[model samples]
Target: MITHIFNSSIVSGPEMLVIPALKKLGEAVSIIFLTETRLPTESARPIEYAMKFGYDVYSVPVNGRWDKTAFLELRNVLDKISPRIIHAHDVKASLYLQQAKRVRPGFKGAIVSTHHGASYRKGKIRLYEEIYVRFVLPSFDKVLCVCELDRKSVIHRGVPEGKVSIHLNGTDRPRVLPEDRNASAATIRKSWKEKMPELPDTDAAVFLGAVARLSPEKRHDRMLKVVASFKKREESGHCKKTVLLCFGEGPEEQKLRQLARTLQLEDRVFFMGYSNTISDEMAGFDALLCLSDGEGIPINLLEAGWAATPVISTRVGGIPDLINSNEAGFLVEKKASDESIAEQMWNMLQNTKQLTSVGQAYQKRVMEFFSHDAWLKKLNEVYATLPGKI
Candidate 1:
């Protein structure tokens, strides 16, 4: 059996992939959560989900850094489960597992890790990646990358190429059925407008949506700037009314809201926090926006393709691999100005006829390259090759 280890306290892209994987793996796998340092709400939902699926679940304190007690607790759990394979979801989990391996030498399971993102780095974060990849990653039997860029990044960081492999992240079909998307969208738009009456009401409104944590890497401030520019265009009567509705919760939430207010986009921009049914709401949008400075194939973007909603994203990380720039969807530069994004949004609104073909192209690519079944089969094959697997 294989045991999956990941952080269960924060709701992020990696957590989204990890939860569904645990559910699908079912009885063949178990999960160990690296307990959050802060209050766990959305992140803890995965643990509840594992329980619903009747899968064994455990937790060990992990404070995002080295914790000797967490290592001991993890070792004890490994001793009890005695899994044939140990799959760590991110760097921290891998670090903890490496320490546990040293402490519990008797448990000889193959160690594996998934590099989830190509995040911006500086100071301690850069130091951590350098140390981890140079020292810790080599010890793993396999280091799975979510994209080709991440695989190269791992190798460039001093890991042996033989130990590294790419297992492109897979996306699930839209959780919301086609019949339900429209109704879900209408209901959300109505309810949100009712809650905040300052937002303009117009039958010609173009809805642009994004679901991402309000973090620096997410570039939410950049999204707000785009919204500001779009609103400027709207004022000039260049197009119909435009609004940017964001869904997700994170540390940068207040700062982003403040930026929105400063940009005088409070009326046109809305931060709806986390939504369990964001997929259902996609049908209401004209296009999904991903303005992150870097990413590892965002789940929201994939969900957009499945929902047949076109995308407008910055060309970063694995994004270009999916979007073909004006064919499948729009691809802005990594440091694209708000005016550029706003101009694209306006053009997309004006050229609604092209959306259908672009969405189809993206959906086709998703089916061909990013299917969940194929990803699971690859993972199982890797697990079977491990030393203790029967």
Candidate 2:
């Protein structure tokens, strides 16, 4: 049996992507999870879902940033399970696994690590990552990356190229039939009107939404600026009234709200905060805007496309690989001026036929490459190549 381990402190796209794939690969596989965050009063929804697929989920407390206690806890778990292969996600988990291996010399499982994104973007590497990559990464039998860009980042940080492999993120097409296009559109419009009661209920109103954390790298402020510019154009009788809906929340929430007010967009921009209903929300939007300064094959893009929504995103990281300019969706160059992003939005708003064509194409592409079955098969292939217990 193949055993997979993961750290789930921050429940985000990476957790969503890997856990589902691991479950679908087969029932014989066992999954063990470790999270430093205190366990919720109730089991996590993701953990519950994995259990239904025959996974054995476990949670134990570990110091969030400290290595000694975390490594000791991990070592105890490894000794108990004695999994045939050890798979760790992100730098922290990988470091703990490596340390555990050192203390328990008889452990025979091949170690595998996956890099989800570039740590350089967050801040200088923490002391743990600095030491781990230089000393522990080379010891892993194989390193997995979610995209080519992330793989390159890992190599640049000292991992050998021969030790790494790239695996693009994937998603399962929704089992539901295609939503009634007209009904879905009308429901979205009605919801927007309720949110912005001052706005008229007409096709003249454009709804733009983005799903991302409120962070410097995500550039939520840049999106607010685009909305503000559009609002200014409307007041000047140069464009239709537009409303911006931003989902997800973080430390930058208060700052972004302040910026919206400063730009006089308080009445036109809606901050819905963090949500688990992203897929349903995407289905209701006219367009999806992604303004991240960097990324690693965001699951949001695939989610939006799967919902048949056209996306306008910055060309960074692995996004260019997923979207074709003017084909699946529009690709705005990074550091694009607010006016440029606004103009792209304006053009798409003015041409409904073009937007519809692109949205349909985007949906087709998602069904082809991001389906759950396709990802499960790929994962099985990866597991087959790993050294297994006889």
Highest TM-score against the true fold, candidate: 1
User: Taking the tens digit of each residue's C-alpha lDDT, what string does model 2 give over 1-390?
Assistant: 556666664457777777767766654566666665655532265566567765677654565566576677777777777777778877767777888788756776778887676533544455555666677788888887777777787789898988888777788645223556556766766775676566546365677788887878898888888888777778888656887788877789999999988999877788876677666657667788888888877888888877788888888887876785578888888867888887877777778788888888888887887777766776666667775532
Give me the runs in candidate 2 sitting further than 4 Å from their true place. Answer: 37-54, 125-133, 175-179, 188-204, 388-390
lDDT of 1 by residue, 123-198 (tens): 7767877777788899999998877788889898888998888887776775444456556567766766776666
Candidate 2 at 377: error in angstroms? 2.3
Lowest lDDT sum, 10 consecutive residues, model 2, at 173-182
TM-score for each candidate, following the candidate numbering: 0.91, 0.88
